[model samples]
Target chain A: MPSTYSRTDLYAEVQQFYARQMQLLDGGAFEAYAETFTEDGEFRHTPGREPARTRAGISAELHEFHKRFDDDPVQRRHWFGMMNLEPQDDDTIRATVYALVVTTRPGGKPAIAPSCVVYDVLVWEDGELFNRSRRVEHDQLFGSAAAAS
Target chain B: MPSTYSRTDLYAEVQQFYARQMQLLDGGAFEAYAETFTEDGEFRHTPGREPARTRAGISAELHEFHKRFDDDPVQRRHWFGMMNLEPQDDDTIRATVYALVVTTRPGGKPAIAPSCVVYDVLVWEDGELFNRSRRVEHDQLFGSAAAAS
Candidate 1:
């Protein structure tokens, strides 16, 4: 059956989920980050880069990736703005989140990279908020002396 | 008399404005870009070292900055996403847009800068969509390269 939520109700649920996601990023809980998605979820960073194409693919790749990230002492922060959440028919959502992700060298001037990401997300099978599909669309890159022309 | 719009309506209006803004940026029409805002309207780039306090500041700065860039003959594209729009009284709006700005060189790769911008916008006093306010806000900046780290 299709899931139905008033636009207001839907926004409310997504807001909570979004908040939690931010918290995890701020905390640098990479393993926890991988857990936010479902077993068969999809996380796509760059438009053409497919780190995970299916449920199993997402799980394996992120689990390993997060494990490696967690081994480092890196602190990460992802600032989100410009979110558009359009509900899909199957209790899922098609949304986009613009993020400014910053990483510093323990204590150093931050490097700046601008990114545009699109997400195709699904709620949990148990009727909770979880991601089924997420496509991270990278629209641009900026402020890298090495990456500079 | 005051102007009003439902949240959904307001979101749509902003979306249209964004699409148009992107169009102008893609075309390299900085003058047209200046026109999107009111005569005294503001345009700001986030992750800037200093904050812009008013529309006049943004307009004059952008006009001059673009003139310099025009002489350099650069190609750049801005991708906007993750927009959160809230309605304010009297047709004013508080909107945040996340932008991934990319600058490209003839034979070089693109540079990406991830920026988080908050806009405190006023609507057209004439009661149409074209109305603009005097100030735009850019709250924070993050480097996208951090995402890889």
Candidate 2:
């Protein structure tokens, strides 16, 4: 950890990283989105559901997720807010944020989807922040009627 | 903002603060939980919902919330994970974490309740950390069928 990173520059950078990740995911850019994670990144959608533990696995899970909902008119949007980063002993940083996932159908107003808590362990490699692991504490919105994505 | 705070002590302190907050809230220690916040702390359960800005108001809100579910067999539990802290220019810090609120009914098994993002602004006052504000970005679980407690 650098001594000079105790200010707001690091905060701004972490915020931008989350904003970019949301944009890419919402824009249906899977490959580009996967690049944001480390080559050996991991993503746990829910506690019991399958976890994507590799870059390729994460990419495939997201691809299949979007594809499953392709025909549905509900447009999913992830809005992340209030990101805070804690520096680790090495170059790794852990970021935690509130995620508001909204869904809008063609004829209806936007409704709050299954929002979640985004826990990300990010690593600094090659002068860039890459996600080492992401765990989503999903809001099972409608209980049994809805499942984790 | 001290030169020595750049090390791991601050990080550990912030994490312990969060852990203590959770323990207080879950232990039914309302006074202690309310004391964790500043005198003028604020809590936003929803974007438009009324926020509790005063210490008394915060205590009342939480009291009412738990009271409503007192008779129910479901025991509400808040499991917080991956707390990250961002230091402000002043001495205030922003902490974000992934929160999983679960409930287990007497006859039913444990089920996940609505999980959301918990964004907390913490300030150090009088040699102790206090919560300045807490913003919960709910996924609007079950739409308007359920409200924040």
TM-score of chain A of 1: 0.70
Off by over 4 Å in 2: A1-3, A82-84, A141-149, B1-33, B39-61, B71-149
Residue pairs clashing, model 2: none
Tens-digit per-residue lDDT, A7-58, candidate 2: 3456656767888988999878888888999999998866568889787888
Tell me the fnat of candidate 1: 0.03
Give the CA lDDT, 0 to 100, for residue B132 in model 1. 56
Task: Name model 1 segments beyond 4 Å from true.
Answer: A1-5, A25-31, A46-49, A53-59, A66-72, A89-91, A124-127, A140-149, B1-131, B134-149
Residues B6-31 of candidate 2: C-alpha lDDT, one tens digit per residue: 53556656655665566567557777
- Across A68-148, the per-residue lDDT of candidate 1 in tens digits comes to 566566565665544556666665676655555566556675653433445657575666777777766444432232245
> What docking grade applies to model 1?
incorrect
Residue A141 local lDDT, model 1:
34
lDDT digits (tens) for residues B85-137 of candidate 1: 66665546776666555555433444664344545474655544542542233
Candidate 2 overall lDDT versus native: 0.71
